[model samples]
Target chain A: MRRHILTYLLFAVVTFVTWSQDTTAVSTGRHITPVRPSTNVVKQPGRDVSPELIEQYISGDTLAAERKAREDSIRRSYPRYPMMTSLWLGVNFIDPILMAMGQDYASVDVHATLNMWNRVQPTVEVGMGWGKTTPEGMNFTYRAKPSPYVKLGANYNFLFKSTPDHQAFVGLRAGFSTFKYDVDAHYSNSYWQEQTDFTLRGEGSHAWWGEVVAGLKVKIARQWSLGWTARWHHLFSCKDSEHSQAWYIPGYGPRGRALAFTVSAYYTLPLSLDRWPRKDSNYSAIR
Target chain B: MPLAWFYGSGTTKQVTVGNVTVYAIGAPGDTVLVNNQSVNELSLPLRVSTDRTQWCLTFMTTDSLFVTDTLTLAYRPIEYFASVECGAMYVFDLQQVTSTHNVIDSVLVTQPHVTNVEQVNLRIYVPTAQQ
Candidate 1:
């Protein structure tokens, strides 16, 4: 009888011990059910984790830092400049030279351009023009009064990423003028041996045109640059052409053609944007 | 071009005029366009400076009689743009035409619109008995 009682007592103690262990696990928020071991499935971590995963995380962070450092070094290779780079005031000399040589048409123009981030240049040009021509192999003698014209345009430099000392650029322009002109044309009849002359005049006339320009601007001296641009133009609308075309189109050179050229000398005027620290690179003291 | 067709017994046909002479009157030397030629068709040019044109036509008949007629034409000159290469030219719209009836019977205004393209713009008919 005593042996049976001892066996019952031991069973009661074992039952109580199992019940307390399950209750402790429940309070601690641990799973009572066994979890399947899988490499893909993620479980709530305990205090201990494999060292392999910890090593992977440390190496990954180091690799990210190294990649960022390499990228930053490569980026510093080019220039780092701000917007509103500089301003240029220029005067064209080609037309005046042509006029002095007794050419038919001439123009005198002064231009201003604002350089932005060494990439874009917004420009404006104002000028006066005149012409007189007894064109070779033609019957007409053409003449034009001194007229004023204006051109507005923008340029894109191909070498914007490089130094601003030399630039290669292509631009587009919209030009306008108000001008007056006259033409005297004589024709002789072969059959009657009679010559007749027609006198034509155009006044209060306005003309608008477009131009595609390409040029090279090179630094010739400190704060001075010499630039040459070739302009191919198309006359969009001209009130003078309906009566008689203006022989000279002020900023546009001669009428009835599509091409002209300009060689200009420029003086740089640095603005507040140019006050940035430029000593970091070989920038040639452009400001 | 003004097409002058001969009509005999109500049939329109080509009949060559004999000893044809045509000249522009107002020009400096009376520019002779066709100097005594036998022709079935002729093309005439107009003056650019004025709206009126005068032509003197002299032709011989079958009976060997020379008949002289004066053709007066008035038009509205239009300044026409031809092409970029050829520039501009003057074209005309025939408004009124009058002719002296010597051997010519009547003048019909066929097509009044004038262009550089070659087409008949006037019809000159000689008398049926003369034809």
Candidate 2:
């Protein structure tokens, strides 16, 4: 009977020890929350609160106020100014270099523009062109004397929100020219087996065209800039002689539709300084 | 004058008749028969070639016995802007025209220049009585 009691006691002891080891292993595998003592107490019914929640609410409000203050300071720094106007004079450099090639055409153009609020520029260009060409395979000689032409246009600067010292623009122009041309050629009919020499002279021939232009300008000095523009020209109308066509137009370039490129240098002159925004003025904006 | 000012220098050549059946001849398949392309009701718009100075147009009648005629035109293509919307086009100045006297009695150059102005430029006189 004593042996039986001892066996039963040993079985109970082994079962209790194994259960304690399993409980210890499960507790160690899980994340344990440390008990911290609460310093603040909430007086709400059936609710308990700590000091960390109140401190977090206070910090969130403080951060929002700081963000608002920073935005207000940025707004105060950049302010809008009143509309201002300036004048610019520019000369195209590509025509002179093209004239040296002796390909029967040359042009020199000078432009004047009014820059308004550094956004829109209204402009007018005047130029003189002349050329003479005798094509190699053709039995014809064409000559055009120096004639004057004019173009009126407006350009909208895309970089108006940036610095005034740099500009990227797109523009439209309407050009007109009246000039004279002389053509000496021989007309031959193969079926008729006849050749006739003819000389045609055209005076006061007028040509008109429209252009879409894109350009960029960069400030090189305090009041000087360097610029380049590409233009796509569409010929609208041209008055020609009965047997002759105008080979070259003064400001309109070739007699047909063409793409033209020009490099220019510009000088800006301030006519009225009072109308311009002061550099140190608080209301002066970059645009 | 305002309409002319708006259309600019681009003009198109239109061929029409008061009371006549006109069919433009084209070669389909292996045979060179009348291709049955009709331009009688609505006038046909002709486009000039960019490289060639001449345009050949052949016409056939729609009667029981078809009579065919060929007209050749010599012109100079002038590049000009038709309108702000149309962009650009070639306007032709009629220099000379020759036609075969088959069913067509005579051909008249009513307008010497052709543009995009939508007007009848050539007048074809066909025989009033058909065989």
Candidate 3:
């Protein structure tokens, strides 16, 4: 697994480097200012207005009107904000570094994602996921209980810029994962050992997690886009609670720490009230 | 049907030790028979069954085994087995017995695709008198 991951990273770096060499400037930097035309101060006979002055005045008025029209056209061409919702079929695998601590479980993660981005493209997302675990497989210790987890998180897109048809994003996420489960205590005492008793109970705990991601969204058809995201994640959970001392929830394992590498693919659809509009040439002539 | 079950699948075929008949069904591939006549065998990689409808067992004999075939054994409601894994057979040591739960010895056995694995929840029938 480690070798496979390293190979993929190397391949990605090579591809990114190769793609960056193109100087097409599909990128934006600081705002570019519009150049102003030179003004002519000349007077005309009878009307007290010079032809040059009238032409200049008309041009100035036209330019101001065109600027306003352009702004309005851009607004009409693209929605001020886009609401997006996505669903993904994901496979998640958790490998245990500490064999004595717990075993690992891999499952198909079903997720529903909701995102809203403002004009500057500030995006926020929340996902709901559910998966299954191996009951008595590997190094798992059963407290004879069911464990469930809920994940809540927020992401900030530092830079978001792309054509109306496609979107590219780089973002960072901070979130919390909470689980409820139970763990059985092993005893050496004969009375306890002889009974082989295991208690079924509920436990609750949370972990603070962060991830950095870069992704691309490509429009496939009307109202639909396919997106792929690669993320590196780090999570830290309390190993033992000060109030209730326990290694960790049964299914989740000891809280000490855990890390996961994940990649996701999603199908997204626009949920905004207004859709992308075509640019109008008339708006340019007005100015 | 009277259902008889074993823990997992693919254990070495157990042979009779002297006149003592060790006719038992625990793992898949365990051969069973009546006297020297072969009866039935099972499929590989057993899975847990919650519904009594899914539990099945067949038998085969060693000698007089003119025909070899498999048949589903009846489920003995008096007996219950869960569809949960118990690791390999070797590593598990009988821990204890509770009012509702029982701990038995586990053994680590290798299968075709898997490495050393443990069997979980091997059933042990404690007589009423013993209990």
Best by DockQ: 1
Candidate 1: tens digits of C-alpha lDDT, residues A78-173 = 565467778999999898787788877888899999988788999999999888877566666667888999999999988876667788999999
lDDT at position B74, candidate 1? 90
Q: Looking at model 1 chain B, report the run of 10 residues with the lowest lDDT sum.
A: B80-89
Candidate 2 residue runs with Cα over 4 Å from true position: A1-82, A190-193, A274-287, B1-131
The order of the candidates by TM-score, greatest first, is 1, 2, 3
Give the true-structure RMSD of model 3.
29.2
Count backbone clashes in candidate 3.
Answer: 40
Model 2, B7-78: lDDT tens digits are: 111223333323223332331222222234534323332333332222233444455555556665667755
- My TM-score estimates for the predictions, one after another, are 0.65, 0.51, 0.34
Q: What are the Cα lDDT values of the candidates? A: 0.75, 0.65, 0.36
Best-matching candidate per TM-score: 1
Compared with the true structure, what per-residue lDDT tens digits does model 2 show for residues A14-60?
A: 99999999999988897887876694566542122234444544578
TM-score of only chain B in every candidate structure: 0.85, 0.59, 0.18
Score candidate 3 by lDDT: 0.36
DockQ per candidate, 2 decimals: 0.17, 0.03, 0.03
Q: Clashes in model 1: which pairs?
A: none
Residues A1-287, model 3: lDDT tens digits: 99999999999999998888653454554457677555554654332233554454567786755565555555444333454422222223222222224533321233444555522333334332222334543423433233343344444343222234465666566655455544432212221111222322454555555666666556666655566656665654443332123333332333333433333444554455354332432222222
